[model samples]
Target: MPAFEALQTVPRSGELVDKAFSRAARAGRAKEGIEAQESMLITAANILSDNLENVVTNWPDFDTVDPFYRELADAVCRDTEGVPGVDALRQNLSEVGWASRQIDELRSEYQGRIRRSGPDTARKVRKQAFARFADICDEVEDDLLALGEAREALKTLPDIRADEPAIVVAGYPNVGKSSFVNHVTNARNETASYPFTTTQIRVGHLTRERIRYQLVDTPGLLDQPADERNAIEQQAVSALTHLADAVLFVLDASGDCGYPIGAQLELRDELRERFAGAAAADEDAVPIVTVCNKSDRSRGIEADAYMSVTEDENVSGVLDLVVEAVGHEPELPFDG
Candidate 1:
């Protein structure tokens, strides 16, 4: 098997296998547990090898293995039927996966270290491997935690901007916030055709006839709690509060914003509350311009008394309406 060949070539495979078995024994699965782990490892290796061989033999395009090893590890952890010391087995399997990944990383490092240090490399490689393994484990944990935090932040974010003459151009990421920005302004900003392409806020100035206004292309806000937003995303949202003359809330009519229209509207209401002051302070609040973008897509939530458009539709019509909504443009550019 290709996986077996790769495993055998690893200088520390024996040590890794021994350590895995030892951990399993300590976890009170000395008898069947060790054998089960070894069998699983061998099976995974063979499957991986077969998949690799197919890819190599095919030369160009190849199908990837279904149920990748990480998924297999998760499955193993969840299984408890007929397996003695099931918890121990799960832990052992996870450890084996870790060891396998570590071995692969070490092998790559060894090549680089050997080239730099010549023949006297064994001791340094061992020390470096230990440090690298610990670092990788810590990094994995930190990333998982950060992802959790980001999800929570996304949830807490308010959705609607009721009072602000704000125009939010929200849609599934990469659905043309930046493109719309370019169309409205002479400013050139990066516009890419990929998800999460705009990681930062890009604001531009747009002038049509005698009216001058600011348009902001905000970072993609997924339907999640506020605590779940990453630092960059939070900053992007914050930037909106600071620079927004009026919000052009953009929505990609074609893509899912991960929630129903009601939920999005609720979020918008929450945003209005958060950014706009109490009912008594309504006069100081900003007005929102709800835009349903990507008109090319037949699907769109009917915006309430606000402007909406498709991919082929120009925003100039909406802009004129917005100018009227906010009353005549200020004689001078908005000082705020």
Candidate 2:
């Protein structure tokens, strides 16, 4: 899933109207009678309005699309021109429709004017309609460009596969959470890397029983409560909260992670609450597997009741626990 930023794929409002009116003018160029001549104007109006409406209709419904992407799309994207929320895209679409209908209404009025007058006067009426159409499209140009900006911002979002199960490793600073992820993925058949827009998070992959799973490691964030984090760090929370099928909440028993055992345990509790909340909303939301790392070193606190790594290089147990939690391991062709 690439960032949703291919706004260049969508035709600009100005360009759409220009092409419609130009084609309309060409089709009506040699017409003689008033009705035939005015019919061309109606045809052009329909083309412009219909094309505009089609573009809006084809856009991502956003409300019913991927939850992973909807989270990113609904936020306010900042640029040189800044506004409030995710409504910019919808707002621009609405304005285009309004302007298109205005053009349609103008065409009807001009058709009447052209029918009652001399040939030259009728030509003037048609010119007035074209000018009004141009003016309306120009007025909504900024809104269209704003939509383009939003699309560009969303384009840089992390390409997480919403279909794959995710194993999110979280804990305090200096915990070997990332190291464990690298160990587990590299130990498997093959490894694939997925980079997030925020540099704090890194993604890895592993395949088991012909099934691929995502392994995520967040370096500096997710150790504290949600409100205490910055905007960028909140992104990590969003991923951990929504996308995680299983979590490995690691605790560095050696106190080398620069946080006390008490703080590490507190963070674990916070993570549980978040997962519980998600579980309430979604029945399939899995629980966290608490892990204590670096048992080889001198330390006081343990990684809690789940599993601890004495080898520091071996994370097979943690991987197995994660596989169990996700409950999606493929059955092999073997007799028990």
- Per-model TM-score, in order, reads 0.39, 0.76
Candidate 1 regions with alpha-carbon error over 4 angstroms: 1-172, 190-199, 220-225, 231-239, 256-263, 278-282, 304-311, 332-336
| Whole-model Cα lDDT of every candidate shown, in order | 0.42, 0.69
Candidate 1, poorest ten consecutive residues by summed lDDT: 2-11
RMSD of each: 18.3, 5.2
Candidate 2 lDDT score at position 127: 69
Report lDDT (Cα) of residue 130, candidate 2. 76
**Model 2 segments more than 4 A misplaced:** 2-47, 76-88, 105-117, 186-200, 220-224, 231-236, 283-285, 304-312, 329-336
Model 1 C-alpha lDDT per residue in residues 281-314, reported as the tens digit of each score: 5465656666666665634567533322334465
Query: What global local distance difference test value does model 1 have?
Result: 0.42
